[model samples]
Target: MVAPPDNDVLWARGLHHAHGGTSALAGVSVGVREGEILAVTGPRGSGKTTLLKCLSGQLVPSEGEVWFNSAPVHTLSSPSRERLRLDRFGWIDTEPHLVPELTAWENAALPLLLRGTGTRSAKHTAVEWLDRLDVGMCANRRPARLDQSQRQRIAIARALATTPQVLFADEPTAPLHRSDGTQVLRTLTTAARSHQITVVLATHDPEVATLADRSLALLDGRQSGAAAEAAGSSDEESRAACSLSV
Candidate 1:
C-alpha cells in the first residue's frame, strides 16, 4: 500500500519545552509520516522523551505548535484529546506496564475491553497480535512470570493490537541485548509499515537510529544546526549523512 502523505500524521513546528532552568527541546520541528519510522536519539536528558510526549500529546509544548492530521493538538478540548489518544494513538513506554497478575493476553486485551469490545473479541484480537509477535506461547503467562524480552514483546503486541494510526515508543528495546534489540526493532517497524502506522521512537541505541527513515538528535535541549538541516533535507545523500553517529 502507498504510504499516506507527510501531512496526514503528526507535525511539529518550533516546538520547545522547559522547566525551571533546563530546556528539553528548543525550536524543534519535525514531521512523522505514515508508514515511516522516525527515530529520536540523544543523550540522557537531551529531551528525546520529552519531544515524544509533546508529539503524542502527553505533555503540552511550552512554545510552538503540534499538529495531528492538520489539527493543532494543544487547541483541542480535553475530551477531544482523550478521544484522539484512545482511538488514534498507541504509546509504549520503556517499562512495560503489564499487570503482574493478569496474563499477557489479558494485559493486551485491557484497552480493547475498556473500549467496550466483547471479552471474546478482545482476547481474540490480543491473541492474534501475540501470535504475530511470536509470543503466543506466553499468552497465559503473567508479567511477573515472563522474561524481560517476553515482557517487551507483550508491550509491542499491546501497542499494535489497537491498530492505532500513530505509534509512539520510548526505548522499546532498551532492556534487550544487541541481537534481541534488533529483532524487537524490526518487529515494530515491520508491523507499523504493514499497517501503515506512523511510528516515532525515542531511543539512545545506534541500531535503532540506523533503522529509522529519519533521525533527529537533541543536544542540551536543542537540535544542532547540522541535525536540523539533516531532518529537513530531502536529498538521499544528506539524509544518510545527517543521521546521528553516536
Candidate 2:
C-alpha cells in the first residue's frame, strides 16, 4: 500500500446536507490523507455520494465546509475550482462519462487537452494508461461500441491519466459481474497506490471495503456510531495538531 503523504489532501468539517426535509448527510467529518485510500461504505441513502459531491466541490454543503489542500472549495471562483478539480482531483462516477462520439483514447485525453497539453502528447499518455489498465485494445473504440466492463476501464484510465492528488470513485464496480468487478477494483486501487494518489471510494461492496486502509460506514445520513467513534479516537490525537491552519 502506498503511504499517505505528509500533507492533508482533503477534509470535511461538520458537513451537512439536505433535500427538502430529508437529510442527506449530517455532521459528517472526515479527512483524506494524501496517498491513502479511504473507503466509505454504507447502505442506500446513507449520504456517501452526497459527501463525495461536497468534497469534490460539485455541490456545496448546507452547513459545513470542505477544504482541499487548506483552501475552501466552495469559496473558490468557478474557473479556479474547475481548474483545481481537473488538475488535482479525479472523479469516476458509476456510469462511464465518456463521450459517445469520441473513441476511448480521445475521451481519456480530453482532460489533459483541456489543461493545455498538446493533442499528441495527451493521446500518448492516454494510450499508455489504457495499456497499463489492459484496455489498449479498446483505445480506438467509441464507448457505445465497448461492453460495460470495457467502458468502465476507460473511465478509470481517464481518471488516473493526470496523476491526480485525490481520486474519488463512486461504486465503480456497480455494473460489472463479480469477477470483472473484483478485477476493476484491484486495478484501480493498485494503480492509485503506485502513483501515490489518495483514493476515496464509496461502495456497498464488502470486498471493495476490504481493500481500503480505512473504512467508514454511514447510516441514515450519518456515519455509524462505532465508525464515528473510531475515527474520533484514532484521528483526533494524530490529526488535530495538524488541522488546516487556514
Candidate 3:
C-alpha cells in the first residue's frame, strides 16, 4: 500500500465494517490533514461513529486500511493500538463518562495520571484546561455535583490535557442544549486549533459541522449523493468561514 502523505495526520482507505451481519460502513475513504478539524457528519445509523472507530483504531475495519502519521494502524495488534490511543490519541465520547467519585480536576487528570505523569503536574495541567473550557470553578466538584454541560467541559479538558497528536470526538455535545452545545463546540475547535491538534469531530448537526475545516457526509453507511465538503446552499458562509480556525 502507498504511504499516507506526510501532512495527513490520519488516513483511511476502502474502509468497511459490519456488526452482526449489518453493514456500518461501506467503502469509506478519508484523509485528515495535519492540525485541521475534520467533521464526520451524518444522521443516526449513518455510519459516522463506526467510521470514526475504525479510523481511530478503536475498532478494526472488516476490510481495508488505516494509517496514523503513515503508520499502519489497522495492522497493529490490539495491545499496540491500545498503547497508541493512550500515548497519541484522545477521545471524547457522546456521554461525559467521568468517574462519579472523582472531582472535576481529578477526572480531567485521569488520562495523564494513567500515562504515569506526576499527580501534582497532571492536576495543574488539568486545571489549566478546565479554566480554558470555562469550567475552572467546577474543578473541585464531583460529576454528580455538576450539570451535563459542566461535566462535558471537564471531559473535554481531560482530552486536551495530554495534547495528543489527534483527537476524536463523537457526538460530544449530544446531551446538552443547543446554546450550551454551541459554546462547547466553539471552545473545542478553538482549543484544538490553538494547540495544532488534528481533530476528527463526529456530529449530526449542521451548525456543528460548520466549525470544521472540511466535512464528509455519509448516508446509509456509504458516501452520499454529493461530494465530500459539499454543504447545503444555506451554509455558504459557514463553509467560507472554514479558514477562520474556529
lDDT leader: 3
**In candidate 1, residue 160 scores what lDDT?**
90
> Which sequence of candidate numbers ranks them by TM-score, best first?
3, 2, 1
Could you give candidate 2's per-residue lDDT for residues 1-246 as a string of tens digits?
Answer: 122233778877788899888999989988877777888999888999998988898888888777887678867777888888988999999998789999999999988988899999999999998987789999999988899999999999999999899999999999999998987887787787767789889998766776676787889878784333223334334223223221
Superpose all Cα atoms of candidate 1 onto the true structure and report the RMSD in Å to 1 decimal: 5.8
Error of 1 at 144 (Å): 1.0
Q: What is the full ranking by lDDT, best candidate first?
A: 3, 2, 1
Q: Once superposed on the true structure, which residue ranges of model 1 sit more than 4 Å away at CA?
A: 1-8, 225-246
Comparing 1 with 3 on lDDT, the higher-scoring candidate is 3
Residue-pair clashes, model 3: 0
- Candidate 3's residue-wise lDDT over 1-246, tens digit each? 888888788988899999989999999988888887888888999999999899889999989999998689999999999999999999999999999999999999999999999999999999999998889999999999899999999999999999999999999999999998988888888788778899999999978887887788899899774334535433344434443343
TM-score: which is higher, 1 or 3?
3
Error of 3 at 219 (Å): 0.5
Best candidate (score: TM-score): 3
